[model samples]
Every structure is written in structure tokens, then in C-alpha cells.
Target: MIRGIRGATTVTNNDAAEIVNATEELLWEMIRANDVKASDVVSVLISVTDDLTAAFPAQALRRIEGWTYVPVMCMREIPVPGSLPRCIRVMMTAETPKAQEEVVHIYLRNAVQLRPDLSLTRKSEL
Candidate 1:
């Protein structure tokens, strides 16, 4: 079966270190939430809000996780006026036997404030 987890996070600034750390935290949460191993991740797509371009969040994850073998790509998120700022979003497609509803999604930081509907586990994980 194929399952996917989508995560989004808002950053306070455009610093590279901050970007890397925030993305690392988000990706870590996503991995742990679904019991997703490195091998389970089929591919990961990342996008940053227009204001953020210090470093690709995908590259940050690659460096932090030492994921020399994971397929990752990064792009710029569409900019709409008044949209979330300094945000890095991830959509991960994984190969798993679990149903779609069983997959875990992550929203972090001020991003959590964006989706109060998610469960406590999801809220606290990131």
C-alpha cells in the first residue's frame, strides 16, 4: 500500500540555521509519527514560502539525517499575499501497508496554530 504524510511549519525568520533546525524537527516528527523508516520514504517534496530561501528544507533534512540515499526535492511555494510567511512544507509519499487514515500528518510551531483540528499526538509530536 502507499500512504502519504503532509507536514507544514512556519518559521520566524530566514536564517539558514533556523531553517535547517525547524525542518529537522518537522521531518523527525513526521518520521516518528508513522513509524516511517528511512527505507519507507519513497520520496519527499518540500516547498518554502516566498520569504524563505536560505536553504532548501529538503537539503537540510538530507544533511541532518545523513540521508545520502533518500530522494528529496525542494521548490518555492506559491506566494499569495497575506499567506503564511517563512513556512516550509513537506509532502512525503511512503510505501506502507497501512491505510490512508492510519498515516500520521504533522503540523508544527505556529503552524500548529494553523490546524488546531489535528489530534494531541500529532500536535505534541512536532
Candidate 2:
């Protein structure tokens, strides 16, 4: 069965290094929470708030040892009024046996405010 794992994180600034580091951290957390393997990932879709323009978050996936062939795309999130800033969101599709509810959605850094209910397992508390 195919499953979609959701995750989001925020960077302190629009620096390329910050974006890449935060994205990598979030992706790793998502993978660990869902027990997902790079080979099992069908694709990864990432969206960053308009305020972030230093780098494409997809670059983070390429840094993963076994994710060279994993398809990933990145784009800008719609600039909703009063919405979160410097945020990056991800939707990872993969083949997994776990049910939807069993999948853990990760929210890290300032992005935790984006989904308070799921913030129980925030990176800082993990």
C-alpha cells in the first residue's frame, strides 16, 4: 500500500545552509518515525514559504546516501495572508504496510505551531 508522510520545519533564516540543514533534519525524523526506507519512497514533494529563497529544499534528499534515485520536487507555498513564515513542508509518498493513522507526522522548530496537535513529538522533545 502507498502512504503519505507529512512533515514541516522552519529555518532561522533564508541562508542556504540553514534551509538544507533543517530540511534534512525534518526528512530524517519523518523517515525514522515511519520506518521508511529510501528505496521504498516513491517521491517527495516539498513546499517552502515565500520568505525562503536561498535554496531548494529538495537538495536535502540528494544528500542522503541511498536517496540519489528518489524523486523529489520543490516549490513555493501559496502566500496566504498571516500564514507561517520561513517554513518548509513535505509530503513523502512511499510503499508501506502501516495504516494511515499509524503514520507519524513530524513538525519541528517553529513549524510546530503549524500543527499543535501533532507537536507532541517535536524534534526537541524526541
Candidate 3:
């Protein structure tokens, strides 16, 4: 079955390094939380708030040892007033045996507000 795992995180600055680091952090957390292997990932779709034009969030995947083969795309999110800035979000599709209810979605930093119900606590065990 194909399952979707959603995650989001915020960068403190618009700098490329900050964006890449924050995106890497979010992706690792999601991978750990979902117990997903790179081989299981079908594709990853990433989006960033309009304010974050310094870097492509998908670029962070290069640092993930085995994720080189995973297909990824990045886009600019619609600029909504009052929406959080410097937010990087991802929707990952993967082939998994786990049911939808068992899938874990993650949100960190200011991005937690984007999906409160799916947000994992900082101390939550994966």
C-alpha cells in the first residue's frame, strides 16, 4: 500500500544553510518517527513559504546517505497573510505495510501550528 507522511519545520533565517539544516532535521525526524527506509520512499514533494526563497528544501536530501535515489520535488507555497514564514513542508509518498492510522506525521518548531493534531512532542518516543 502507498502511504503518505507529512512533516513541516521552520528555519530561523532565510539563509541557505539554515534552510538546509532545518529541512534535514525535519526529514530525519519524520524518517525516524515513521520507521521508514529510503528504499520504501516513492517520492517526496516539498514546499516552502514564499518568504523562504534562499534555498530548495529538497536539497537537504543530498545529505541523507541513502536518499539519493528517492525522487523529490520542491515548490513555492502560496503566500497567505498571517501564515508562518520560513516554513518548509513535505508530503512523502511511500510503499509501506503500515496502515494510515499507524503512520506518523511530524511538525517541529513554528511549523507545529500547521498541524497541531499531528505534531509529535519533543519528548515523544518514536
lDDT of each: 0.81, 0.91, 0.88
| TM, every model | 0.88, 0.94, 0.92
Best of the candidates, lDDT: 2
- For model 2, the local distance difference test gives 0.91
Model 1, C-alpha of 26: deviation from truth (Å): 0.4
TM-score of 1: 0.88
Instruction: List model 1 lDDT by residue over 1-126, tens digit each.
Output: 778788888789898889988998899888878878777778899999888878777766676555668899999988989877888889988887779867778888877665667746664545
Worst 10 residues of 3 by lDDT: 117-126
Cα RMSD (Å) between model 1 and the true structure? 2.1
The lDDT-based order of candidates, best leading, equals 2, 3, 1
Please report, as a residue range, the 10-residue window in candidate 1 with the lowest summed lDDT.
Answer: 117-126
Least lDDT summed over 10 consecutive residues: which range in candidate 2? 117-126
lDDT of 3 by residue, 1-126 (tens): 999999899988889999999999989988988888999999999999988888888889989999999999999988989888889999999888889988888888988888777665434644
Query: In candidate 2, residue 84 scores what lDDT?
Result: 89
Which is better, 1 or 3, measured by lDDT? 3
Q: Which candidate leads in TM-score?
A: 2
lDDT of 2 by residue, 22-100 (tens): 9999999999988899989999999999999999989999998989999999998999999989999999999999998
